[model samples]
Target: MSDTPQSFENFKLNKQLLLAINEAGYEKPTPIQAQALPLALAGHDLLGIAQTGTGKTAAYLLPLLFKLKYAQGKHPRGLVLAPTRELVLQITDEVNRFAKYTDLRSVSLYGGVGPKSQIEALQEGVDLIISTPGRFLDLYNRGEIFTRDLKTMVMDEADKMLDMGFMPQIRSTLEVIPVKRQNMLFSATFSGRVEVLSQEFLEFPERVEVTPQATTAETIRQVKYAVPNLKTKIHLLEFLLRQQELKRVIVFTKSRKNAEAVSNYLGRRDLGEVKVIHANKGQNTRIHSMDLFKAGDVRILVATDVAARGLDITEVSHVINFDVPLIYDDYVHRIGRTGRAEKDGEAITFVNPAEAYHFDKIEGIIRMQVVELSLPEGVEVPPTPFVEKQEYEREIDLQKRKENPDFKGAFHEKKGNPGTNPFKPTEKKRGNKNSKAKKNRSQLKTQSKYKNK
Candidate 1:
């Protein structure tokens, strides 16, 4: 046996949880867990900024379980808020696994499903609760779950929570929870919004940021391709998917429509077991689809922004950006799905020529130039030409004036002025009838001259 004590024992967890940890085969502590556990066990608020797949789930789950177990019967003693239903479920799973040997019970609350089941679970006064912000607040509003005795609150994936527009829900939830207990904020990327959340939620917390902020995981190989059009994007994606037989792949699209379209296209091509998950799908469908993907029954998963935040599938071998992520932080989280647990993985992003600006921002955040992937032969790629609308309009206006002989000059000039009359014969203007007679004589003279020519 190693000289170092078990992680559970080191954290001074109760024997039951310790037994569960050893039985679960957790020998060493992941970096985030190792650093954040001790402080959390001491009831101190902690800000843990680590990349995805660094065992952040266990980092908070292990200690929170111990805290709840140590102080039993404090109804709804711990609350964990995740940005997405997937992450909420994931946290619940981790807590359940860690607390298997203990009397610590946990309930999951999320949207897409009805509140009937969730309310029933809450009515039972569970020891711990993990939930998404919207569903949690919903249940709270219905008097199903209250924050009266909430001793420890943990926000998992705080950065993603902000990205998903959960700030309002999160802030309101914080208002209900007791301020006397511990607060922990964990995320893959830390932004100004995260700082604001920390200031509002945590009280002089110990900050522990393991990886460099604005950086992607070190194990992922980032690849970029400069494709021209949407059709070419599909062509390249098809070629790549065929070239490498990925065990489990995720294709990220910019919109739900595109995700469904991609899923349909891949399925039509006889690609192995393609599926889609987005807001449009019912909760049961999403949960079942994700479970199938995790079970390896579905090989490819096409998803929109909703699935970008909280997916924790470990077997995802490749992450392809069918549409390059517009937000810089999303790029980090997407690729993070792969290359987890120090496993080597590939992240290939399709960069449409028009989206080059967005790609530049993503590259700047990851702190490295993404390697360009070569396109298959005979593919036409379009370039985004720089055309200023204002400049083009000015040129078109000038051309229109040049083509029209009736165009008027900006400044009016005396027609008979010495310099202006160079091409005109000098003539005297007559008044009234005299002017008519003079105009008729000029017309007759011009007609006779043209006839002679």
Candidate 2:
């Protein structure tokens, strides 16, 4: 319990884990690892509050590896649940890397692919099973996997799991697993939802906060550009990518359609081997794209929030937010992809008028104002189109209505006659009056003809 920052050796971790750690070039424990490792090793239910890339993975993995030094049974002794397939794979890779010196076997289970391989891996015997909740449940329900022997259950990125509406699955998982197992929950930001989730899952847990909640890494320089529309944002993106300093960039859009569109735009513009990844993409495609980006074969990777949480590429020089994430906490995870491992990086956000409200919320959550910069002089700043302008206005008005239910938005204002109720029957009544007058005229004409005869 020395106040001085100590090396990994001081943790008294398994020699095999120490060898792997040294080989991985990890000399000193990160703030999170140093604080959480001892408590976790001591078998405490832990609620660790720290952002991604804070070595939370290692914090949990190291202690778990020590406890399960070698593989013993066909059933998994360690279970790690993540929100996305990418995260499942990432955590699995970390396990493989750390447990290299041991006989421990681990497998990653996620959907979007055949389960035959996963079932086979489980059959062959795995000590650790890293998985998404759905695929794990699928396998468990099919009797292809068993978890009665699970000694440790780690919920990595627990906040994201809740954000993605995985609470029910997590609850189901809780019901299936042994109630006596150790529980560890890690999150970048601890929201009210996470607090409630922790209450249901964790015992009187040791609370570990490496930094203040929802705080962005100081290593990343954040800036924003108020582009007028999507087209302008694209032009701005192209302009920014032209700079030599912006190498190994990840452009995050809010939707799959935008991710693909951005990738196509960049590819057409010859912006150096662009790749796109979203839920729609095949599992192999996502994995290949990630590999290419990691190898520097792809210069820019355009992605949605699916890749926001657990991507561990350390050399990302820039993170461009083509669309401001509506979920403000996601903005923290997005920016976290860069400025990882204490490397200085940049996070640039393109905020159209429609997204300005979301951008403000992001600022509020991060507790710092992102410096708004004027668009680069040479870039063509296109005018916001009529459709986009209306959309932006409507979004703003909707947000206003949410805040003040009585406040009628601009879109709700009466466009025609102020005194007239558009939903009323004034037109129908006028039509009936005209018809009656025509009938009276017809009767009068008949009477005139009879008098003339």
Best-matching candidate per TM-score: 2
- Candidate 1 is scored at a TM of 0.81
Local accuracy of candidate 2 as per-residue lDDT tens digits, 235-271: 8999999999999999999899888888998999977
Worst 10 residues of 2 by lDDT: 420-429
Q: What is the lDDT of residue 56 in candidate 1?
A: 87
Model 1 ranges off by over 4 Å? 1-8, 70-74, 378-453
lDDT agreement with native, every candidate: 0.80, 0.91
- 46-74 per-residue lDDT for model 1 (tens digits): 99998877888888887888777743563
Clashing pairs in 2: none
- Please name the candidate that would achieve the greatest lDDT relative to the true structure: 2
Listed in order, each prediction's TM-score against the native is 0.81, 0.92
For candidate 1, the per-residue lDDT at 379 reads 60
Would you give me the overall lDDT of model 2?
0.91
